[model samples]
Target: MINLDGALYPWRFRLVIAVLLGMVGVIAWRIVDLHVFDHDFLKAHGDARSVRHIPIPAHRGLITDRNGEPLAVSTPVITLWGNPKELMRQRQQWPALAAALGQDAEVLSRRLQQNAGREFLYLARGLTPEQGDAVLAHKIPGVYSLEEFRRFYPAGEVTAHMVGFTDIDDQGREGVELAFEQWLAGVPGQREVLKDRRGRLIKDVGVARNAKPGRELALSIDLRLQYLAHRELRNALVENKAKAGSLVILDVQTGEVLAMVNHPTYNPNNKRNLQPQAMRNRALIDVFEPGSTVKPISMLAALQSGRWQPTDTVEVYPHSLRIGRFTIRDVSRGGGPVLDLAGILIRSSNVGISKIAFDIGGESIYRVMQQVGLGQDTGLGFPGEQVGNLPNHRKWPQAETATLSYGYGLSVTAMQLVHAYATIANNGRMVPLSLARVDQPANSTQVVPEEVAKTVQGMLQQVVEAPGGAHRAQVPGYHVAGKSGTARKTSAGSKGYQQNAYRSLFAGFGPASAPRLAAVVVIDEPGGEGYYGGLVSAPVFSKVMAGALRLMNIAPDNLPPPLPEQQQAGALPGNGGRG
Candidate 1:
């Protein structure tokens, strides 16, 4: 007011310019943050309003036999999902959607009304191909169809216990499926599909991410052998009227599982009809006291210890062995004055074998058993495999050693017993057992001397040829070495054995010259006139062995060519050299 001039005017203008500059700088900094530094946070603002997400499922893989025969496969399936939040906003329109989808309106209304805040919820899984098409045709705002896979068992119950089944979500749930889930399940992929404001599909933006299918699996089971074994086991169970039965055939040279069969089986595809026990894999999971089949193992120990020879004679008491408070006895009295070691096997004399065990003592026998992979897992990659019970020497009572000597006090699974016998058949070499074949290197440990194994193998042969033994186990064209077992099922609380309840077993291998396959058949509670292993299990061995031999096309050793009718006349006499 006192001095008005041009300089004062310019200074006042400069202050106003400075204030305007500060406001512009603040706005520019905020613009940089929102558009550049915090761009993702700003973009998230539009997610709820403009973006739509969908799930993509990966394809499950196929499980096949070594020869490419399908065991497990996946068929095309569809799943229905809904966004509850979107559906609830149009609750009144649910009836229209329900009618178009051919579902009950009341049910759809209830599902849509449940917790309006839910973003994703499954409506139905594993829909039939036709039903899936109908759901897609509806084109409802919240409902969608996703392509998926469903497990199918082509071999049905024949391969169920080995291949196993998947859960509803196509995840491995049991058997090989669960055991090799990492290898069997594929990696899932994702895609982004743009939608308009009205929820109508628009053009694709870019390339889609493809899912990787699961890796294919090849198993060691042979289809022909598996079928034959299953058929025989089912018929045998019905004929014997037994509670249950199981059989396994192993390649003694390769340790590959040729066949595995269990009775009271259920179709994995039709799981609704399955019973609790029908699903059990008895061959690998269940353990029982293997009566006389265990005799061969003890014989190996005895021979290895040089305490007994194949022909060495030992007098067997007619009835029972009184050891402390317990007594071991034979089913029937042996007919000879004194039984040789070979005679003891032929007659299955419990008393004589127990004496052999007594000579070898508990320590040597236990060491051999452990070395041959008893009282432990078989490492076959089976689920729920039991490690059989073998009481320690320190825990054994005065009578335990004698009873165990005759295969009473110890327990073993069918696979374990088979492997032990296969070790003997392989000339004392312990091959790592395999269910699936690969190029893995072989590892072996000597369980017994080669001489000892040969001696035991020879003695086991007489069990099938001699009288009062398992003659039915003998194949006409093939020489066989095997042992029969019959053990009474022990009762609870140590009250002694149960009457008429027995586990009958026949374990053997054939061609005797060069052992090939070792097989075992276990029949539980065969309530019939003949409850012995010779009667119940030997015939199964014959059938399985004959089939296995024929399947492999192995020529029988030392067999002459068939003679013509005219040439047959000279073959019956000492003129047999004339052919």
Candidate 2:
């Protein structure tokens, strides 16, 4: 029955066959276009949707002290980011996301809306690994985390001013961080990565650029000494109720800054409440009149002029010297009516020192001070270092000269004072100061004659060892040489000085026989019962020097003899009168 071959096929059947064949041809054409002719273009288009070029962050360098202890380091952290458009689409989940991110919902919403057009917006800059993990565990869409670094100061405020700190973006903002930003910041790399629709990383396609890590930096600061200085200075500040203070320790031979500390320092790691004043490196920035500490320098000038000998005597009867409407009085009441050269320094007699300065002339004293690196930067290359104010010798009147001899009419930084004392310790050669480790000893220029330095150092030893000298400055077993200074704080605009405010200063070196360390301690505006440098600052020197000498293994030169009956009964030497 089906044998009717050649019977005409239905029109519907033919139409159906033609339609099927056309569909096959179109499918074949599409396959060829996608897999052969336009493969690269189509693949690129697909990649553009799912693949991303992300930056690979490089780590910053480490800052270490001279002994290889880390002062500043970069620690890995996570930063949360979001695609504003994608995040907005999941607005209902915002409360949960904001809770996980520790942000207010309204604040998060406003921030997202403000940056709605941005493909990348930071939700939180620095986050702990646990925090980032907690956010990711929520599985909120469009939220992403990136690896980053946060600066950590291991020494905290102990070395804060010296090592400084970085900003959230890893840029150095202060201290050594700002000074060596170029060397500390590294280059970032780029890599192409494939991501899923939910913005989860799938696979790394390829690396475009390799990241370069920063180089390491080694500073000259000895952490042990730095800690010691910080502890002592902080204690002194608390005890004296001083407004602020600074302490600097220098290597007498090498000119390396072993320790530099400032009071009222802030923690660099947590700078949320950091004040501008707390961040200042007061040792190098703040300047003040050096007061009676400069007596030795004036004596040095007098001796160098061939006009005064170690045995020379001066009569400061009534303890006052009148010069051109200015009266210089001795702090000593009864014992300073007459004194020898060593007695003058031991007693800290302002009138006696003034008499010698008048004999030597102002130019000689100014010349000696200038030669000792006063009124100049200490060559530390620190940011905002002040050169201080030393008036020209030609501008000095007779009264000004008398004041200059007693360390008034001029200003000096704590660092400059340390440098000057270090020069004396180095036997008159002024070495360039450094904050970084140096391979070789720095070159020095002779400021004072070697004999003059030795003689002055000997006289300074008397200032610490004499019966009425700075007995507080004496280390238990080490011979110490230093001078104490107490100067009235000058008012901001007026020529007159503040009545009660004073700057207590002590400068000296330890192991006096062969000086190894020279240090300076300045307590600003001490509001305690005793404001004299000998009473306030000298004790700090004694403690710090004792520790430093022991740490350095320097042999002590003096051993105290057994105390007499009176001394054993709690009566210490140099406790009778003001220095």
Candidate 3:
């Protein structure tokens, strides 16, 4: 205080204060630049590093039976993916990563090399949440997981051919899955997510679009009936040692397919069992000569021609008829008995039916077959459905007409055959087949006069009920109406029919008086000593029909009146004859 002014220079004090103020000004300007001018640029760069737009996987549609039972569905799963560029840098950790993923280290290395240029690579798909979490627990950098969906088939091989299957990407690849892929697929959404520098997800910021799930599909098949058909058909196929087979059950009233199954099926859930031969939907895809199953239709045609009546007569006692260079023979050896029109169908007389076809003219038979929907698509919209070969002969030859009477020289699918039988069951009206559930009664068209259809039903009932009939086709509590057809398959690399290989078939409906269901069973190349339709295919029809009649609550038209003396003596009715 005595000499303060003399102790310091004025310019030096001013310079100290000025220097401190300049530093503060410089810092304030820097804050302004960072907060205002460069704020958006820095924020964008930071977002590029830590904020990521991730896809939200959508779920596929469901497939259900007529009763809303889930046949096919999708479950949420985790898909492991990685940035090859970033993952390759952590080569030392590859063994651990592969171990966690249950993949070989060498394989992982090759995969990385294969996708070196790819920014993202799929490590695994359709992994269960547990599996994904176990791998994620390792916290391997650049390895991330995204949500996905995997298809699960609950009915397995029982409904495999009909419900079909999907691929790893949830893409429908077979059967109904392929038929309705568009309707079964969903739309994926996007969301912004925050991640750490190691690429681990931190938090979801906001959703851009919510995922839209696929729509559900309902099929016409009842799971209960489908199960019954599958069990019976599978058992029969295994017992017969057949190469392949198909069985189709139709709701005669509604024309809806209740159950359609194939042999040598594959479980859709298991990818290892996939084979073209096993996955084929034989009922709709494969065709064969219908054999004597067409006898009812031939009689229908004969009666419709007005040239013949149910009371007409033909001499089939001789068991053989010479027509041109071909000879038509019956299995009946005991001769000299004339049969009426109904008797011809009951015994499945080739000679008698051929006479009717020849007298009525072959064109008439062909025309009636056309009206019955033979050689045509069944309108099921099934993938790979075959339009069978029904040659329209402008002029009918005697030999061809004889073969036609016995169900040869033409090919038909099981679906088409059942569709015809359903027409008769539905009172001569051809029912429109449906694979999906329907809300209304089938829109049917009268393919024949209702009276003719009823008459044929009565005659077909005789084929199962009468003595020397297809007695194996008779059910315990129902008046089964059907026919057994045994036809020799054509020899491979040759023209004539094979002696051993046969296509055994049975087709008809149950509760003959007021039929509720129509079905067809075809056993291709059955093994062992039993190859006749009555012995092989008719039994399947009986068991399946019996169950279906009970399940549908249809009143039995004929309950047996206790065991007969022959049945009690272990001599089943008509158990020894050819179909």
Candidate 4:
């Protein structure tokens, strides 16, 4: 401490070291904070400049037949969308964009001006991938292409009535498309994507939310049978020069609608200039008085009432049945004075059916009809299905009851008629009708006595077997039991019957010994050589059934009997009449 100007104190040395070390420590701490503590925050800010959330398209569910044949498919497509605000700033590119989209430049300008306030607007929808790629190649600002799917029907017009069609935006419009819209429309998702300064996608970062594809729907239809039905129905329509027609085939065991088709149908893919009425699924929605087709059900009622036996004979006055102010007449003549129930149905005598109906009372017949699904909705929930009309039988007078017995007062869709027949074919047990493939048979209800049903079914077999009574409906190698009806259509206002307006119908099942399939065919306004159900509709039924039974490998129940007296024994087994 003696020479203060020349000597340094220990405190001063310690202070100098402290200042240097503190400076280094502060620098090291700042480096650690920047590299570790604040790393995530700074990185997020850096990404915000180029990161984006993009949409991931969800495809619609596939529609297939029971055999996994694709009926409706979702095809990959691209949609062009844009941010109007951003697009408006690049007005110079409008002409190029319009030319790419095949639109007028002037029109595009007006549309853009009207939509400048909107953040998003669609330029084109359902464009081909090539078209979208071409548009994107131009690299127009604010214009973006989004991947999407369009519903395409492979079966086209053949399965149009069942599959239906969708709108341009992929929204369901009619048929199964509309009925199961909720189940078929999937949820779209989002994903994080990296983009360049020019708004071009660079990389997929990660899925923000995974897309959920729609569940696949397998319908109960068999495409093979559908084609068969369509071909046969179309032939009938063209051959008979009929206005329209419908045909339905149902599996008796499972109550499955194997095939259903309608005429004057529109292609699902091409709906331009499509008539609204052409889209109607006539088989399910169109209602007609079943005509003579219900005659068997009437006999079923009579048997159930214990008032008449199928073998019991009724005194007949041909074309001579008068009920109150109305006179019920049969179109046939030259019959025996006394006719049994079998003969009555064979000739389709309105008088005989009416007498049986009146004796048993309309209430009895109504009970049977009601149990057989008349005026009831099939649980299939098909779009545009009509419940049809079934008035209270107790309110019917004698004339009304008689007409009801012969299938006039009540109405039935082709689907309902087939259901009733299928029930009887299933041994009087009613099962739920299904349009979807079912793993198990639905619960059955005894709508009519099994014995009554069997007896009536046998009587129908005899009628079909009888000469000149739906003989045309016989399927080669199969024993068919069915009824034919030629009814004069009522006037539009229900005022009275119209002339030259007939609905020819045939409804029956094959392999009568052991029923497996039931079908119904209705030909409207047949303007050909013959218009009777047996002539017009029966031939179509026979062709379709023959092909269907053979296709299904159903065993031949009616092997042609050896010719009586060996007359024309040379005739083919399937072509020769019953011996």
**C-alpha lDDT values of all predictions:** 0.82, 0.91, 0.89, 0.87
Query: Per-residue lDDT of 1-579 in model 4, one digit per residue for the tens?
Result: 376632457777778889999999999988898789978777787689889998788887999988999999999999999888889899999999999999999999999999999878999989989999999999988898889899999999899999898888777888888888999888899999998775678998999998998889898888999999999999999999999999999999898888999998988888778998899999999998889989888888999889898779877785678766878888775457777888888888888888998899888888888899877888878887999998884476897788889999788899999999998888899989988888898888999899988887887787688875778888777788888888778889768888898999998888899988899999989999988898899888888888888877889988967677556665658655565
lDDT of 3 at 405: 75
Worst 10 residues of 4 by lDDT: 1-10
Among the numbered candidates, top lDDT falls to 2
Summing lDDT over every window of 10 consecutive residues in candidate 2, give the lowest-scoring window.
1-10
For candidate 1, the per-residue lDDT at 75 reads: 89
**Candidate 2 residue runs with Cα over 4 Å from true position:** 1-52, 194-203, 334-336, 393-395, 560-579
Q: How accurate locally is residue 376 in candidate 4, as Cα lDDT from 0 to 100? A: 82
TM-score of each: 0.89, 0.86, 0.86, 0.86
Error of 4 at 364 (Å): 0.5
Task: List CA RMSD, all candidates.
Answer: 4.6, 9.7, 10.1, 7.9
Candidate 1 local lDDT, residue 139 = 69
Put down candidate 2 lDDT per residue, 481-547, tens digits, no spaces: 9999999999999888988999999999988999999999999999889999999999999999999
As for TM-score, the candidate ahead, 1 or 3, is 1
Q: Give the clashing residue pairs of candidate 3, or none.
A: none
> Per-residue alpha-carbon lDDT of model 1 for 1-579, expressed as tens digits?
676654769888788889999999999998999898988877787655566655567777788876789999888888888888888777777887777566799987877777577777787778888988787776667887788889989899998887888988888877888888888898877666677775656745443667788998887788888998998888777888899988998888778887888887888887777797988889888888999888888877888888777778877765577886667777768667588888888888888888887777877677788877778778877888888898777644546666777787788998888888888898998888776754553677777899889888888888887787789898878889899999889886776788779999999888788998899999989976787899999998889888988888877863667899877886667675644
